[model samples]
Target: MIPVIKKRIYLGLLAATMLLFAGALGYIWLTFFQQDGGWLRYITIVAVVAVLACLIVIGLGFAGIVLSLVSEKNITFLNKPMNFTFSLLYPVVMWLGKVFKITQDKIQRSFVEVNNQLVKAKQGKLTPDRLLILLPHCLQERECPNRITTNTENCTRCGRCPVGDLLPLSERYGVHLRIATGGTLAREAVKKLRPRAIVAVACERDLTSGILDCIPLPVLGVTNDRPHGPCFNTYVDPDAVEKAILFFIQGGEGNVFHVSAN
Candidate 1:
């Protein structure tokens, strides 16, 4: 939902930053070669080299993003480099997006999409026991008295919310399932369970941040539906969750449980 004007502004600023660096490098080179200096020439050369190296890395990172979007085949080699670059650049990109008055939700959705691409590029698979289904507490109905954060078995399977359906899904798939109220609890669950892979459900912001936080863990993020509001009475497509689980379990072999990039 980012405005076209804001996106243009951000791109303009990014281009300007790149040009500024290039200009600085050019000035350093000119100073190093044109002047008959000793240590200063060495210093300028080192600075120019460093700047050139940074520009090359940034170029590669952007190229990875483009390849992930256009290339149909798996580019597994780009996974780690793209993730590392994205993690390092996200804050600055977000700041510029904000300065340009871009929509926060749009930025977050883009982040999630990039994260998803990076994860898919990894092409990793895990067994049911090594997979974890991490659910946000908001998926629970506000009126429901069940406290399934500690023990999901406390649910009565009343079908009032996703929790009821998720419980059976976890059991059927034999994957670890836990409900976390916040990032702290989610991290704790991840630390304790130590699953090789994760299927996480949350809002756009949380999902984006969580995916970034759990890099190299191969998390498939499934966004939740917010019917009532942002946090309360939120719901997730149980089928989407199932498909994500099956994706890791089955390794994207057949279309029986195919998961889209939603």
Candidate 2:
């Protein structure tokens, strides 16, 4: 299946859920207001109107996100609000996906795909030094005695895993490269480096959560391949990582991965 198809499915589910919720509210207003109790009726009307207003704002934010996916130029104004809307609606979307029996990983991967498009739409050129490449600890060979989590530079350039290949890319591009053992370490690395943008490599779950956690900071996620199992010995495409790096530093030019809502 096309990767973006899942994202479109997610969006469709979200829209259907919102429509159903609004229909329920309308049904309540129509059924309850007919009895006419006085102040209670007024209060109910006010509450329903407020909820509808909130939904309208959410709908507008959703539209902005859809627009960003198709737009080639960065829509700078909607960046923060779109991030906030994604954070707000993610749980609801996940629940909806569960109702429809969609695997959470599929939904998460879809979310990441949509998010990458949104980030690409809003991201501008940055100095290479301001870009950070975050790698999962699993990228290192499982048996390697060296622990690169503390310091990625500890790797002796041994070609045991993708880490060795990535290290040279970092050096060549003059970008900050760090290995994160988990979410906590990833957050800490972001805090310490304070990068303008990030190119992250991880599984679907981690990448989705990490993107949401780092609000307003553009991150292009490259999902890793789990050949052996979950986290034991994962691998990521070094070419995807390089393209993501170039996308940020060159502002959506030069072999950047492109996805659209269309």
Candidate 3:
């Protein structure tokens, strides 16, 4: 199953690469090389919008979300106009995260975690607290490896891994946190935990499905810090995840992680 998901991601990337190369070549062929205007005609309109949203969400972190209420028609949409609208509104909520200094990378990483939640939804799984972490297996620089599969017993609750700090933070105001290897694992973890609210981490590719999967659950999707593609080496921003969790999960105020909805 892991291999299958990997294959899917690989194929998706390869196809995207090929399409980009072909488009570039095709444009050069028709333009300067052929002395023609060229077909600037075709574009990744829908894909572009997805990319744009991803950029705004990640690049600007939640700060760019300040513009979320501008309206879809104001932003230019080629397909899934409704999706574009919803995507645009992310700024408003995410912006709350940025106000708290949740860094863009952390926001993107959270979305990746949410991707895991989506898979849980398909299996009818539920989570217990508001904070759900679908983190990569690797540890932060000098940090111990996450033991999600092993009950986090080795966790020591040292307050190192974001979850370590999260345990106290969540407990302080009643929030929950879970870590999973990937999307499928995340969903399963969430289902078993069954939290009432959710503050999730994931990437754009995973966000759409993950956020949508937890219907009726108020979920705030935060992106991760993977400059490279997802894999065993991906890194997550614990600070950002914590901040979002503090906001949406506990409604806490005035902390390094506190973010307002206004």
Candidate 4:
């Protein structure tokens, strides 16, 4: 398994991350102390500080998300928002890690252990045919920045996406890739698909849910490469996608690689 935080590296990153918040505090202090020095100056300082604080909050949230990507560890619990819900709030459910001191490394190891169970299931140890794959349309035309969702009408089955590639693999392996519309759709779709194993692909956004929703059903996350943006000209790491399929179908012989934001 890939080392999750490389303790030393994360120590440094943790420090850098704290600085963003610190900057916000320090700026507020400096401005608050200087208030009444000038109306224009006070307004300028506060405005800048407010904007900086907004950015810091976002930076902190994104940093946390990237942290999730670094470690595929099982995050069993989460938290309610701090009363300031905004863009992509549900993903913030992971902030419980901060209070819980969750280690990303252990989470990754846990996933491997779970997948190993599925591997055992594949060895005639259990004859289970049900298998579900989450194929979030993290795909787009090679040159176009349009994200294509699952539609026989739109995709044209041109094989331009992992979804396209997954179609034939599903036919050959008898597995289904649920092209979910969103996190909610993915959750419901998985319930209906009800496979014995799951091979899920998503941006880091839906990964943990993809893993958690299919409890005991061995789920693997494949974060698609984002040369542009989410769903916009995006592509699943083909190697990762294929390996997930292979690992699910072929057992111990198949490789299950780790997700890395670095």
Considering every candidate listed, which one attains the maximal lDDT? 2
Candidate 1 local distance difference test against the native? 0.75
Query: What is the C-alpha local distance difference test score of each model?
Result: 0.75, 0.82, 0.46, 0.51
Candidate 3's residue-wise lDDT over 39-147, tens digit each? 3323334344555545443334222211222221112222233233234434543554465565554554443443333222221223235346554343322346645
**140-202 per-residue lDDT for model 4 (tens digits):** 466533344444335546655555555555555556656666788777776676666667776
Quickly count the clashes in candidate 1.
0
Best-performing candidate as measured by TM-score: 2
Better of 1 and 2 by TM-score: 2
Estimate TM-scores for all models.
0.82, 0.89, 0.42, 0.48
Per-candidate Cα RMSD to the true structure, in Å, reads 4.8, 4.6, 13.9, 12.4
What are the runs in model 2 whose C-alpha is more than 4 Å off? 1-6, 255-262
Candidate 1 local lDDT, 148-244, one digit each (tens): 8988878888878878877888888789998999999999989999999999999989997888788778788899889888999899988888888
Candidate 1, residue 99: the lDDT equals: 75
Number of the candidate with higher TM-score, 2 or 3: 2
Q: How many clashes does each candidate structure show, in the order listed?
A: 0, 0, 35, 5
Question: Where does the lowest 10-residue lDDT sum fall in candidate 4?
Answer: 78-87
Candidate ordering by TM-score (highest first): 2, 1, 4, 3
